[model samples]
Target: MKLLETIMQRAQQDPQHIVLPEGNEERTLQAADAILAKKAAKITLIGKPSEIQALANQFQLKHIDQATILDPENYDKMEAYAQLLVELRKNKGMTLEQAQKLVKDPLYIGALMIKSGDADGEVAGARNTTGNVLRPALQIVKTKPGVSVVSGAVLLFTESPYGENGFVMMADLAVTPNPTAQELAEIAVMTGHTARTLGGFEPRIALLSFSTKGSAKHELVDKVVEATRIAKEMAPDMQIDGELQADAALVPSVGASKAPGSDVAGHANVLIMPDIQAGNIGYKLVQRLGNAQAIGPVLQGMGAPINDLSRGCSADDIIQMIAITVNQAISLKHNKDGILH
Candidate 1:
């Protein structure tokens, strides 16, 4: 089965509660209607119920009524959620009044819902900026235990014959402009995890660079080599190698020629680019020139699964992201329970 089909099936088997802060947006409501029809997840919309319903009617979205709409204006548990926020932010001198006022924002309330376990995951940014969407999540939900930074990965369905049946994952594509060696190591490990859980394949990760092995010496190449070592220490069982050029990472012949006897030099299914510039340029080049279907910038290392969408996303994009978030939530639960390593 296709990767997305498998993810959708898994979501159907064990649906999660996913909250959408942009409930009043037309495309989000449309996607919510579709998700309700598919039973992919239980959706909580953070907006006025009546207004959402009216917009649904305007769009002729039949299944929007099935979504649970919690109005930010008059949520029943406002005080409770506000208190939760105050507790979370009290160290930062956040007062109850400040928390109460902030909770009235749909984005803040949606994140608080996830933080309180009222929802399992969150999807937003249809009408909001990336910074605005992530602010509440970072403030409330925070990063996962032992994780310092949040990174984004894209699951590229390529037409190439390499990379686990033409499926590959690349990371640091949407966030983190110039990560240090430690942060790069974390990104590599987290991207590998995303590959296993969402891509349904064992990850052979390559920390990409301009140099393959010690063929060239530079501070940048040194950084990748250090990251590779740190990543191996982090996830010792994972297949990771690096300071490899793009060709050595993806091409079997080049990998063999460049880095002989290395486990991950040639057969890498997860490519961890050194920085956002390389990642952004690389993914786009493949997506446009190679005609690959790029699925994410799936946000990783959050305390809960909270994904940000491009403001220009379509309803179908939202639907796919919702399913992805559900699967991430499931994976996180399994990891916490030691069901998956």
Candidate 2:
């Protein structure tokens, strides 16, 4: 709630323009109404205006028209956007006709808006797969400078004492599978930054493994150990340690005993999972069993702010994602000067 308030204040102090590609989806429309009501940011819905309006009236979603609605078929900038897309993809063997066809996709159009600064960010995936939501961004928005890999982090919150300060970040749950040492290091950096940005803490990062400080020796543990070294080398000022067992990462005494002289042992607020299986299963376990609130698969390391929603996400989820996206926009507009980077 405090985070939401902070987002609201930031959004009000400096509004961001957000584009939603799944404008025809009921949940998106519902969220648009609430986000507009909160003035969380200016939202533009990508949909056929007439059909969107008719559905809004039928569903009784208020303030539908408060957000701009654009249909790619009839948008005034379609051709210009097509030309731009062609220019962007010309080296990739794209043609004017191919660009024209791709521009018809709402996701591409929304991505174009971001590339052109027409919008500060884009959020979609309620009605589309993560791949569909991300492809256009990969093609147009690309990755931020110095970011080699992109990962997704879920910020989980709970009242359980196991959670550090009632907050924690679990990484690579929605993206990246079987990461190498370098990729794992990147995920750690991204998750650490995400924890600080959204959770309001100095990150104590734990690169998790089944072993604790070489208590066990295997290729898996070796990978974590190597990742820890790389992460420390890359982020010396960050309090990070790795090759930690899950309990050692969370329990202070266990961490002290298992990983003596380590800064992140037993004090980690961010967990960098080695692979998607662990990352996905770990977050779900905390969310479902520990009764923690799982807030994201917040896609990280993008050139501009963009996010993907679970198809089952609620309107409230969308609103929260919009808030997070706005914070990301703030980070970008102010010289990438946020805890996230």
Compose the digit string of candidate 2's lDDT tens values, residues 179-218. 9998898778877766666665688999999988778889
| Per-residue lDDT of candidate 1, residues 178-254 (tens digit) | 99999899999998888888877789999999999899999999999999999988898789999899899989999
Q: Each model's TM-score, in the order given?
A: 0.97, 0.96
TM-score of candidate 1 against the unseen true structure: 0.97
Off by over 4 Å in 2: 337-341
The residue pairs that clash in candidate 1, if any, are none
lDDT of each: 0.89, 0.85
In model 2, the Cα lDDT at residue 197 comes to 65
- Model 1: lDDT of residue 177: 93
Off by over 4 Å in 1: 336-341
- The residue pairs in collision within model 2 are none
